[model samples]
Target: MTIQQSYKITPIANLLGRSGSSHLLLGLLTVAPTGTLAISDLTGSIALDLQHAKPHVGKDAAWFCPGMIVLIDGVYEEDHNATTSGLGQTGGIGGTIGGKFIGFSIGGPPCERRNVTVGVSDGVKSENGDVTAGAGFGWVDFLGVGSERATGSKLRRTEQRLLGPDGAHTGTAKMVVCGEVNLDSPSTLEALHKMLRSYATDDADRMPMTVVLMGNFVTHAVMAGGNSGSGGSIEYKEYFNALASVLTEYPALLRRTTLVLVPGDKDPWASAFSAGASAVVPKKGVPDIFTSRVKRAFAEANREAGVKKSGVEGEAVFATNPARISLFGPAHEIVLFRDDISSRLRRTAIRFATLSHDLEQGEPVEADATMMSGGLGTDSSTRENTMDVDTPTPAPAAFPSAESADFETLMARKLVRTVLDQSHLSPFPLSTRPVHWDYASALQLYPLPTTLVLADAEAPAFAVTYEGCHVMNPGRLVREGRGNQIGWLEYDVVSKRGVVKEDML
Candidate 1:
């Protein structure tokens, strides 16, 4: 059912009275005591049959994990077999509803935008001030920038004054993000230097406000027992020292822009313990223990430039792997995550086989090898023959030209949808994508951010926009064999648009 439909979520306890009638319900999808799937809410639980259930959005199958909260549209049959137990058996919610719910369609709850949730807009506050300010989480500062209700309006006005087209400094609100920088690789450092110098040439007023450098700073697992890994944690510290040297050269850039360092799975601490294996989500940032030299470089640069507002003073921030950057409070939020999520998702993805649309339409259904490799291959032969049968429900203006989307483009679209629709960075089970239970809240994308910087070196570098949220990947900073060329992303915070850029030496 569409959002516009007027519907009430029938409580599980109330299901028995409305037997054989269709109704909508909101509950958690879980396994019952009998090992069968069930849905449960506070009132009680009922057995669920989703074998033939389709996603509410027919074009794409909504991801359904056991712990996910979902909306189900189905009919309740009181006479259906009770071999599958209901959730009431496992919890103290209530007695079993004694019915089977045959689902028609299922989907994630509709996402809320920042403006609506924060009451940041003049119109929103004027119309629903009492409700939004009191009920919404607008008073909580998720990123520690400032509470949305408290500073959202003031920051927004400042944002327009500084970033709006009619304002004075329009182009200065830009961010430069580089994907993977292996400090051990001289070429990568040289390429980064070139990128820095290129930006440093811009007038002071036109400089980017932030420069994000994501990691895997070393060429290989620093903790692995080998010649390369011999240095271990100490060697890892030296790599940052080398990077510090690079930053010292461009003191002007360091003094002007905020340097955000986001660690990768292969970065220290976690790497030292996990041996570069799949680390937990919301992993700690590169420990201050190693980033001291990098911090020193920033301090030296600041001292060279003299005192200024602490907010404008250039400083290096070692942010958590999955970090949120709030600019203009709730007006804009940028999420930075460095992981090969595209690869992990495909490895654990549920592959379903159904008749292709082409076959149903009596058209040729050609199977290409590229479709099997997670749509990363860009060979013309593969692109021409492969059909994007699995493309997510196309957005009205998101793709613009759906038929012409290549495998890489299709992959980007799939990645964006799966992450945003679920409203969680890691939607897979704990086994597939381990998340720190306590910090799991950090991974939630509720009221989705304005932009997501998914610096996945494994995923093809491409920018995709879905449902007003823009996701970009810089891919591998310097692909092997592609000498002296570096790929990165330039995002215009004012316009909320990103352009993939490459610098060639």
Candidate 2:
């Protein structure tokens, strides 16, 4: 089949505008007979040349094919250096450049070598303009490139062997559900229950379910009067315990389920506080404790289901059958089974065959010495290829002082705050105002499958899957102004249902 296509190209002058036009260059070429394909920029700003070599003696020749290529070139000048008060103050610039060419190659098979070169020169600038010229050349052997693509040997040998034979239950299913619930409000819980019921009753074939909880689950409680110490209130403890009890009763409902939790800022423990120690403790530390306690409750439930130990140390746990369920927590901590569900289901079998036919008439099957010419002799060639193999590397140990690591810890905490703040600032209106959670607050349970839960009790239960892994903040309900008026509950289909392939982009 032959396919030819072309389109008008537009370059974006401004990065911030919606109408800014930018084009991505991508091409694919397969030539049966060795040939050359050249794409020269009609605008004279870029050029691409590709060629394939003829067969060498009795061996196959090298072929050139690129999956993608991108080139960009333009003149730019910063106006800030100018002394003029008009356009210079607004960061404007004026310049003219001669010719510039840039190119990149991607996804070429083995036995091929690819080169990318950029050239820039000849430029004129205004009085205050700053200019620079540059050129570069890069060559890459397609046989051993980077981590993204697998070589033929690795794919055929190692991967094939690892897959081995197919087993029963090879078919897989995935379901993602996300939604928001008000931790302080009982009615919100009712809404969550309704959502969960809908998912529970849905047909698995059409909408395989995996649950993801994003955003805030609880309002933090504000501390008042004497209850201001590191220790949380007995009421707070009872509240979470009760919530755990409720969740445990629905264990059967979650058979084969995966849960993910992302905490929000309204969660009381996201703030900063004094830990009786000489150092300052983060408010988030409290919610983390609560999350740990809640996880423990889940572990207890799992044990009831015959699991001897809880897989609380990582984002995934292995069942008696060795089935895995991965968990991803706040700050993007991902826990997953070694064998990914989708990959397992999509495995394909690959095999190669050699075709031979008897030569016409009395043609000899064996070659003689007389057939040799120019250092090239004809004889049946035997190709010896290695089969499947696996090389394992030792897992790295965790940092000894991660708990006290200043830069990474601070960056992580800041990132958490930024995400929550951005979510809160989203244009979507909240049904109720957010409430602050405090040490002794009681949080009502919203019955969504992956409802993000947070707590304010400073020393709430918490756990990190691994050293350097992000800590989890258990779900909690914040105490509003005494009367228990629940804060806002916003329902989002994206959050309620886990991220989908399309949603990822």
Candidate that would win on TM-score: 1
User: What lDDT tens digits, residue by residue, belong to model 2 across residues 83-154?
Assistant: 544332223122111111122221111110001011111132223452332332212111123111223234
Residue 199 local lDDT, model 2: 47
Each prediction's whole-model lDDT (CA): 0.71, 0.26
Displacement of residue 145 (Cα, Å) in model 2 is 18
* Candidate 2 ranges with C-alpha deviation above 4 Å: 1-147, 150-172, 197-209, 220-239, 272-286, 308-505
Candidate RMSDs in Å, in order, are 7.3, 25.4
What's each prediction's TM-score?
0.78, 0.30
Show where candidate 1 strays beyond 4 Å. Answer: 1-3, 11-25, 29-49, 55-66, 75-101, 120-141, 224-231, 308-312, 351-397, 480-485
Report the poorest 10 consecutive residues by lDDT, candidate 2.
Answer: 383-392
lDDT of model 2, residue 173: 34
Could you tell me the lDDT of residue 53 within candidate 1? 61
> Candidate 1: RMSD over Cα atoms?
7.3
Which residue pairs clash in candidate 1? none
lDDT of residue 230 for candidate 1: 34
